[model samples]
Target: MSEWRGVAQGCAVIVGVLLAGLAGAGIWIAVYMQGDPQPDVAKAARSHTARAADLLVTAHVDQQLAQLRTALPWATHLGTTVADICETYPANTGFTRRTWTPVMCTRTGTAYLAFDGDFREHLAQLDTALAAEGWKPTNNAGDQPGLVADLDYTHRPPGDATAAELAEAAARPNVATVRYTLPIPSTFAVPPGAGGGPFPIGTVEVAQAPHLPTIDDGTAAHDLTLETRHFVDWQPYSHTQLSTAYPAHGAILAISVRLPYNT
Candidate 1:
């Protein structure tokens, strides 16, 4: 009888250990599920970004594009729309915070003519038109690499131009960049209590920086496969550009204008 009583006590001890293990696992899972709380500034920045995106899509994008189209009547407006670019901030507190702010937008317009030919003249006209709209060319300080703030198409070698220059001049669908700094009021305005003053957001290279939207179309642009179809919102040019293939004479006009605040 005493041996049977000892065996029963051993079984009870095993059951007690199993029950404690299960309870500990449950507690651990609960703690893990309740991730670290976000900072108030992070929350404010996200909200501000959303509001800025909405304003760009609803009011600013069309208005600005209209002005541009009028300025460049020969160029076909491909697509232009604001996207919610996700930005991640790593914290030393064992968790990473992700937020979207400093909203970005990209525009692609094309001319049926060659970039090194008649399009060069048109671009100079565009510079003048943009200046009227408060966009000015940056000096050497803010000039971006591989992109020129002021394009000098008339430049020729001191003597006779080389064969490379001759071929480059006649190359179809070539690219020329013209950088401009526009003081965009949209980026400056923030929600109350955001705790940031009026300062320049710095140069925003939309193509290089910012994670593109998750949406994919499985289309190929040149050798690379472009999953995100440039436009994130349903703007006037979205549907037409998505359906249309880049024309044979299409001179790709990539514009990366940063709308930072005046410091």
Candidate 2:
């Protein structure tokens, strides 16, 4: 009877040991199957593919060309409108801050950004980036870089060569370089009938630091006042109409002058 009991105990101990070994083997297999470490080759291949894709894009700009092709016609009208905003700011007395606020918030508006910076003297700089993309920023101490100002383009009758001579002598390389120092008025006003005499009916105090040359560079003309009916609001030229982004900003001015290039 004792021998049988001992034999049974020995069998149980062997079974226990075998079960423990099986459990240990199972744990080892589970750990091995799970993700243990980063896969070096796969990571390297993925990085290489990303770099290749970037290179492929840089090597080709057809995507940009395609986008421009679809957007050019609209861009032309928008550009012209922007030109009007700039050309007319100094002329309109009825324009308000609300209307001109977005003038410098976008591309061509950026060109006039500086003007906005100092309202006492000028409007916001028009961002020319839209019209002249990637063009370097320009500054000429309040002068619009290429603007031709004070240019008398009208020709005299056959006898008077003086007018023709003056116009010829004043021809400048870049019309935009013609700088104008406009007098800041105490108030904005237009009296009785419209479109008469020295606009704005106020004194324009010109800055004397940079002396005005004998030939007018369009730098001294300042007191501007536009008639109510002739006044054009800046709305259709907004980003919505201009960009694929937002709506057109309100307009504040409109200038129709024949300058150097017929001005």
Query: Which residues of candidate 1, in runs, are more than 4 Å off?
Result: 1-53, 56-58, 86-88, 91-117, 139-150, 153-173, 186-250, 256-263
Candidate 1, residue 140: lDDT: 45
Tens digit per residue, CA lDDT, model 1, 89-144: 32334332332233233222221111223545655565666667665554342233
lDDT of 2 by residue, 1-263 (tens): 99999999999999999999999988976675542332232233235443343233322222322333243322222222211111212222332211211011010111110011222122112222112322222234324331211112111123455776756654422112232222212232222233333221111111111221122212222224422111112222332222322123222111111110000
Candidate lDDT values, in order: 0.39, 0.26
In model 2, the runs with Cα more than 4 Å from the true position are 40-50, 58-72, 75-244, 249-263
As a TM-score, model 2 comes out at 0.24
Consecutive 10-residue window with the lowest summed lDDT within model 2: 105-114
CA lDDT for candidate 1: 0.39
TM-score of each: 0.44, 0.24
How many angstroms is residue 87 displaced in model 1 relative to the true structure, after the best TM-score fit? 3.7
